[model samples]
Target chain A: MPLVGNLRDFALHDFLYLVDRGYKTGSLMLNRPSTDDAAHLYFDKGKLLSVVRPQRRERLGELLIRLGKVSPQQLAQALQTQQMNNARPLGQILVEHGVIGQRDLQFCIQQQIEETVYELFAWRDGEFKFQAGQKPAPDDVQSLVPLPVENLIMEGVRRVDEMSRIKERIPNNDMIVRFVDRPQEKAANINMTADEWRIFARINGRSSINEIADKIGLTPYAVSHIVFGFITAGLVEVTRPTGGQSSKAPVAAQAQRVGSTPTRRSAAEPAYVEPPKKSLVARLINRIRGL
Target chain B: MQTVKMVISGAVNAGKTEFIRSISEIEVVSTERKATDETRLLKKETTVAMDFGRITIANDLVLHLFGTPGQRRFDFMWEILSEGALGLVVVVDSTRPETFRETTRIVEFFNEMRPAPYIIAANKQDKDTAWSPDELRLALRLPEQVKVVPCIATQRDSCKNVLLELLYEIMETAKEG
Candidate 1:
């Protein structure tokens, strides 16, 4: 079990290489070739656990362009025009500028997908490394390829459901939720009932069950029932928040106990401030001042 | 006429302000002060918002160079500065290897901002015991696409080379799009 430095450090080719070789359990640490900053990629039985590229620090656009969705001219013009106007992306710009038609752009994107799959398939130089459990289906081309945006968005929504459940149980201040619900997934799952779907929709990982229930005008009990249904469907699972502590405080007496500490005083005092009361005449005058 | 937004970023005390001053035609406005922390050992003071410098490269091309604040606390300004940047030039102190993290963070931040093209200038390359561009690139683990140029920001020729590399990256980005 020799560990590689940073999975992120590996190029797309290297990542595909490990997967093709059937190396199931290992982490790939990725560091920029000329910088100290690094990111990690955890693989569980050849499945991606998570990719943690810090916020505001990944070059997804570069990757997208390299994949050949748009030409360099399109990117440059988009960037230059964007600097002046501050509207739209290079992809959109290409479409607007009539440099590349919508159909051509879409075709290029589709080609990029096929190319990525081909690259992943050609991971091994020359070896057929198959493992014991669940041999990947030969025709099941989906597994070898990167998940589509639709699938990734669905996974994101599922995680939000799990997060809401854990937040309900813990109600701890350390809980800070990051993922946004996938609207595309919600659009796809239109078959579910409105109320049932509302539960999933409201569970954005940032909102607790109670908060979600309040938002959707459902009782906490009703929300829990809908949540349980989602869990039974194998759509979600519970896990501790990624960072050691949750940012939200627990809703019970624990808040009081935590508040008792001097260090925690700074965290609690902000919520306790009271607005000064005004007399009825003063209130009326204040309201009338605007008129 | 096309306006190209360019960001200038580097580790603290890496002559980011002075670099801007050397090239900028406008008066450099900054609060000059003594070194406050270990960052001071490398250089002193910090850019708070973003240091803005404008240059007209050609009749139709106006390059707006935005310098970012070096400290981690000012990391938030990166998003604001990089809104529509065509590329970034990350200045590095070849003399101080420890500032590599700060430089990396800035580079990462730029990558995330918008697929803005970027180049790294191993600033102060004229100084004692400077690492070669290859060594710096290997040590920093920069992406293959990113160009790292060795230069002394204080020298006009060195600064011109750094600017030229950035222009080259920007042109390449344009051609690729």
Candidate 2:
């Protein structure tokens, strides 16, 4: 069954995160109501294989020609050869015929796919339906490696209007962020840029996103954007600063009184002591088992 | 009598009432009213306040179950019901991906308020459209330690299994503590 919903209800970055994490193999068909435009994203085992705009119907050979990487005559010959041997992808034929290098073809296709995704991210409303186990056309495989949605999400979130979504987690500029336990394990696949790396290094569980931005001389939006991406990737979490620490002292103090501390606590701080007695838990377990 | 509480929560129409009704030994006390908001589109009646259910552990021990209202306006009730909860069962309508975000919000609320033992009940697992527990885990960004149990809210055995999984989680926490 296909998963269908409008982007208005579920944001694009979120859906992409679902696709990436679910490792879904599907074609996400998106249609813009206002423009009546349609876009197709093909995925294989969670990675984006290709993106196609039905309106354009622009094949790899045409894209290479538009990129000034291949001549019209070269594309024509590749098309003829591709027709003769329908099994081979046009990009592969172009690479084999020396019309375009393999590396260049891959880079070109990746860029095209990235740009299409970035554009789709800008869309605030669209009908999206994901049909599982749907792959791109055999000839459209293009000899290019499938693009990881993680990297795409990192970039796409930056391009799209996603502060509202990020605010759901970060909430406010005063919210402090700390690394999740086993940070290295979670950050393994994350590809952070120079600016993102700068912001990443500033996270000490003591600095707010605003403070990080101030220290790094970047805007709060830039810092929050990166931190939001980190959060989505499960690399970090946001929390209120300790009591009497910030301008929101009263709220922070209340948080302390309520014992709503972040998961990670210092050695000196009191540990969680509210687990019900083991005897009680065991009895409940036994009772439920009998039920 | 000694009383322990476990809060059952989820988005609107995620089947919280159905879950409690299936397992609660007493007639489940639910303050359901005709839907006035957008929830009317999903179901004619919505849990306006909360649902109360119970199980007897022993002659002197009683287990109380509270189901929080599934509307944003009633979020205040969540904190009140979550107080002193032994564990939490976050029910998710596995067939609806749109509600997954709301489900995550509910989990975050409970975690922030009181980091107690909790398990996700992926309800409506019998539906062909339901997302698997593994997929729900990824979609919700739940950690590996948190359990996501398959469930059918309408089934007595299924709801009992969910409660058992939550108790086991609580037992592990109690042992660690």
Question: Top model by lDDT, which number?
Answer: 2
Which regions of candidate 1 deviate over 4 angstroms?
A1-291, B31-50, B58-61, B175-177
Model 2, position B175: C-alpha lDDT score: 56
B47-149 in candidate 1: lDDT tens per residue? 2433545555445444556676676665545554555555678888888899888788777766654556678888877777787888899878997877999
Task: Summing lDDT over every window of 10 consecutive residues in candidate 2 chain B, give the lowest-scoring window.
Answer: B40-49
Q: What is the DockQ of each candidate?
A: 0.01, 0.11
Candidates in order have lDDT scores of 0.49, 0.75
Alpha-carbon RMSD, each predicted model: 26.1, 22.5
lDDT of 1 at A152: 34
**Residue A89 displacement (Å), model 1:** 41
Which CAPRI tier for candidate 1? incorrect
Instruction: Report the lDDT tens digits of candidate 2 across residue range B1-177.
Output: 456789899998899989998998764345544435655524423335456567888876778787877877666556556656888999999999999999999998878767788999999999999999999999999999999999999999999999999988888868532
Candidate 2 C-alpha lDDT tens digits along A1-291: 799999999988899899999999989999997978888999888889888776655566555554557776787788899899988777888889987888888887787678677768867899999999887876452327888899888888876547658768978788887755433334443434445545654565667876676555455667888889888776678988778547232111222211222222222332254878888888888888888
Which 10 consecutive residues of model 1 chain B have the lowest summed lDDT? B41-50
Residue-by-residue lDDT tens digits, candidate 1, A19-97: 5357464444444544333344344465543333332122323333433344445656766876786654455566787
lDDT, model 1:
0.49
